[model samples]
Target: MAEAMPQTLLHEALQKHRAGDLVGAAPLYQQVLKLSPRHPDALHLLGFLLHQAGQSAEGLKLVNAAVATAPLHTDFRGNQARILLHLGREAEADKAFRAALIATPANPDALRDLAITRRDSGQVVAAAKLHARLLCLTPADPATLLAHSGNLIDLGRHDAASALLRKCLLLAPALIEAANSFAFLQITIRDLDLARDWFRRTLAAQPLYAAPHSGLAEVCFFENDLEACLRHSERALELTPDDPQIHVRHGFRLLAAGHVREGWQEFEWRLKRADRIRREGLPPRWQGEPLAGKRILVCAEEGVGDELLYASMIPDLIAAGASVVIECAPRLLSVFRRSFPGCAVHAYKREGDRFRPVHRYDWLPKDPPVDYAIDAGSLPSILRPDVASYAHQRPYLTADAERVAQMRDRLAALPPGPKLGFCWRSKEVAPFRNLYYTGLSDWRSLLTDPAIQVVSMQYGRGWREEIAAAQKAFGARLHVLEGVDMTDDFEDILALGVAVDAIVCPSTTLVWVGAGLGRPVMEFGVEPHFELMGTGKHPGFPTVRVFTRSLAQSWEAVTGAITDAVRTL
Candidate 1:
């Protein structure tokens, strides 16, 4: 009779729980537990009800108890994992989920949640495998297709992603995520006109959707419609104020539009992104204050060119009377040491977005231990808030004097004409970046010119063969630096940069270094960059003149303008 009473009470409790009568179901579940202490169903149901009532911690305890009682119960395990995930215990949740999958290998819900967890943790490849497995089980499920499309996109399988998105839309036409992903796919293919129209249609279907607004902002940006881009960006920000990426892009637009102060403020949000690895156990960031009798750490960021660009502010920190420590690329360690004698420079590697010093053991005399740390890119936000603030900062880098003289003598021994440094392509050649660079063949006029000797400042492998091929193709007068590894030895590269008569490149380390040294440089760009600060020129770098060509023009057509400028030099 007692056993039957507990079973009857459990049935009543489950009915009340399903009906959302938590207050009435609680006492019945308690009575079931009092009579039948090991009732896994009662325990799990009570835990779920508690979880529903916003008591995840208490619910997790009950769920774990239920799982202990019935180890093979799929519902108990799944509910336990849910409570663990809700309590932010990811590792435990993963274990619980794995157990659930083992018990019921074909469970669609378990597979979907595990795949999403992998994706959220930046494990796209793992997520893709799980999504593939899920799709096999539920091939006709539209939600699975939508999720699998995102994984395919992240894996760079654009065609497969597009097909899946099409299938998803066909199955569920009103699904906003499928529509948004498909629209974003058009942008990835660089079909801006098609993408813009698609985004507009999406916005029409759901007028208040923030994603389409963000998509339109990106389209407007690539098309050079800065005004329209900013408007869309602002609208996206208004709709989804907590989005970090949107704020980061809006910051770039603000800086490109000349709103310097507001731009820097928005740019600070980049640190809050998931990809930006948070630096734990570090001192607080240095706000613009007197750093007298204190020490600070400046983390290296971005590429070598960006490092040189941001190094402009390190000298200012020293001038304001603080001892500064910097972690930079191994290639720039020797050069940075020579340039900033007052600061300690160490080699570093990037972990996601932040720089980690190879050796903090060699930090400057620990009379005062490091008190604050700041990203190199963040320095300008504190030191140079406006255009006028950049004026007082002088040309801050110096190449080795002896090496510079030796390189000058070596170059003088060439053909007695103006020797120019050239970088025809960026290291990362993608659809978005291809517009900024031209092939060596496009440098036809300059390469064939007998009047000037163009030194190959181009880094990376196969460049030697490319130069050799170019020379063979046209009998051109291009020379490689005989003794220097141009890619890894920035000290030697800086010496060569200082020795050259002029530098002509799209955008690279040499351009930033040339600008820092006030050397004459001609920068060929296809669109606006934030560093130009909406002026189409470097405000602090007068000798670095910018040259632009409309996107409609062929890159080969723009080389003649470069040749013309070189002739005058």
Candidate 2:
């Protein structure tokens, strides 16, 4: 009779629970538990209800007790694992999930949850294998397919990821995540048109989704449609105001379109991004103000090319009556020291070193004090706010005079021809920016010219083979200044800029170096950088003449044009 009473109460509680009356079921479950204290069904039901009601801590305890009571119940074990996962006890949850899988092999729910847990814990390979198993078990499952595709993408198996995503879309065309993933893959491969189409389709299907708008913004950016880029980016920001990437994109688009004021404000958000170095324990950032006696530290950020470009503003900062201290890349320490003799120049301290550099103001020997610290990239927003504000621009950086003289002498010793310095490619290569790279083989027309002595200014390794191959293939004598190490010797490179008649290259640091030294530089690129936005001329360097590849043509056309231009020069 007692067992029958408990069974009746248990049945009633389960009915109430299934009917979504958690409150009505709770007391009944307690009554059944009182009648039959070891009732696993009552315990598990009450625990699940408690968890749903936000009493997760107590609910987890009850679920654990139920699982103990019904030791071999796979469902109860899975429920316990889920409760543990909800409480962020991932390790404990993983153990519980494993136990559930052991109780019933090929348990779909357990496998799925375990896979997700593995992925979140950064055990990606294990997660991928588990997802693959889930796929085998439920081949037509769109959600599992999408999850597996994400793992493949993380593993950089994009083709496999795309295949799975395609299957997911075919199964369920309105699957927004699958569509977005497909678009992202297209973007990765630099298929801008396809990415655009996918993003548009996604937006049409789900207008309120902010991700597609941001993806469209990126597509517009790479296509050089600044207005469209800004519009999409702004819309994305409106949808999700806290997204840092959207802000950064909007900032760059604004800068490219010559809207400096708002652009800088948005660009400031880069400080919050994960990739950038966060300068901890720094004084407040400087906002353009008169600093008669204030000491300021200008920290270098980004690549050498960016540092060189931003170094143009140091002179302006100096002119504002601030005693400047610069922390730069070790390679640029000598060059910057030479360029700005009045300011203290130091190489950025290497991270994780036992000994740290004593970063004190040049004027104050006793105290390590500075009124403000700022990123070098931020100076342009304050100093050159508009295209017109760059009026005072000229060669701000100068090479070592002795190195210049030596390079000039060395160049004079070479067989007489119009000396042209050229770089065929940038050191950094990505699918999106690979359009800017002109292969050495593509430069045969220019290299074959007997009237021009093409100097190899392309730095980094693997240049020698390309140079040798080009020389043999074209049967032309391209001059490489034998002793001048083009890789690390920036000062000598600057001297070589003076030595050469004209500097011709794709958008690289060498072009900036040549331009900064007041040399005649012809910049060849597919897309204009932000500095070359308005006038197709570098705002800071009047000597640089940009020759960009037309939308309809490739680098061959660019090289042909360069060949003609060089001949004329």
Candidate 3:
């Protein structure tokens, strides 16, 4: 009778709880617990209500009591597990969930909650299988389908995600989340037009969906429509101002489009992605004073060309009156040292100087003590180094005199007419950047005509098949140079610039280097990229002639352009 009294009170309290009146539910549950000290239902319900109200310690104690009283009750155990999961007590939650499932083999809610917990804990595949099982039990549940689709996409099974999304849409045509997911999948497959159409549909169905706006912005960015990119990104920022990735993407697009001042300012948000940029002891010093007489350390972060581009800022830093210490790549020590005689250059890999913690400078200056912090690329605008400035540094890059002499002798032995250098692919992985890689068959046309002598100046490993094919097809016309240690990118540019009559390649730093040195360069690539060949007649290199693919033509057309350029040369 005493135990039944608590159960009767618990049934009444549960009604109040479900009616959204926790205030009325609480006292009734406590009275029931008072009537029967070990009543699990009253104890668990009161505990969950307390926890939801943020009295976690009191709630946990009550929940533990409930679980202890009703050890075999699946509903009580599953509720306890959900509370643990919500509190992020993952190990205990996993145990409780498994025990609940053991207690009741067909608890769909338990299975779904367990899947959510596992996914949150990074057991992705396990979570995915559980979600799949949950779906079989609860078919036509849009929420279940969406969860499965998310896992599939995370596992890179875009096709599977797309199929699931289609099913979800068919079931519920207004399902915006599934539509957005399907739209993103289209973008992943490089079907931009189709992706754009889906994005439009998604936005039409649900205008408040902020996620597809990012997708639209990405499409604009890839199409090189800076104006539309800016508009969409700004809209995204207005909707989600605190999202760090949004700031990073907008900043990257701005920088890539050459809007330095505004771009660099927004780019500072990258530091917010983590508590610190690198684990190194250096901290951002934002003392906000004149740069003169201040000792500043500029650390290296990105690629070699990036370092070179920004190293051009050393003179500007010195001019602003700071004693600059550049922490750079060891391979670039000599180059930077030569470039900035007024500043101190240190190798990033070096560990000898352990003690100076003066002031730190990164590309982004949150609290700059000195006057400025400019990334390598941004310094160009501040310094405004004209073509003549770079031109005077004509042989700005120098190779080992011995290596150059040795390479000259090695090439002299080859039966040469007009020397042409080759770099058929870019090391950059982005499809937009990598899509401009020159096709090998393009080179075949130029080499098949015996008038041109080609040398394999390409870098990177995995080009063995292309090398073998080029050798097999072009025979004596193609000379793959050996022993010409193509170590650093700078050396690769200098060697090809001096050694070749015309450097034929994709859009890369080499294009800038060759054209900067007045070496005739024919850049073979697709059309939209032709405009990216730089601002002026050739803002980066005067000697560079761009050959863009016409509508619907393969690289064969680009190859024809290269062959014509070789003939002229």
lDDT by residue for model 1 (1-569), tens: 87699899999988998898999999999999988787888888888889989999898888888999989888888888888888888778888878989999998888888888777666678789999999999998999999999888766687899999999888888888788888888876668778877788788889888999989987787677889989999999999999998898899888888888878888888877765645545677788768987789988765788889999888788888888998888888888888888888888644432222122334434666788888888887888788878887678788889888989888888886789988887766554466577778888889888888888788877778888888889876788878776778777777888999899888877788888777889888766577777887887888898887765556765688888888887
Write one digit per residue (lDDT tens) for candidate 2, span 1-569.
86699889888988988999989999999998898787888888899999988998988888888999987788888889888889999889999989988988789998998899888766677889999999989999999999999888767678899999999999999999899889978977768889989998999999988889988977887777888888888899999898777788788788778787778778878776644564656777898878778888888876688888888888877888988888887888889998899998887654521112223223322354788888887887777778788878778787889988888887788777788988888876544455567778887888887878788887887888888887787775678888887878788788888888999888788877887788898888765356574567887688888887643356777778888889887
Ranking by TM-score: 1, 2, 3
- Alpha-carbon TM-score of each model against the true structure: 0.86, 0.74, 0.66
In candidate 3, position 172 carries an lDDT of 84
- RMSD to the true structure for each prediction, in A, is 3.8, 6.4, 7.4
10 residues in a row with least lDDT, candidate 2? 352-361
In model 3, the runs with Cα more than 4 Å from the true position are 1-51, 54-173, 184-192, 211-233, 242-260, 263-280, 285-289, 302-308, 325-410, 417-419, 428-434, 447-449, 457-461, 469-559, 566-569
RMSD (CA, angstroms), candidate 1: 3.8
Best by lDDT: 1
Tell me which residue pairs clash in candidate 2: none
What's each prediction's clash count? Answer: 0, 0, 5
lDDT of 1 at 69: 90
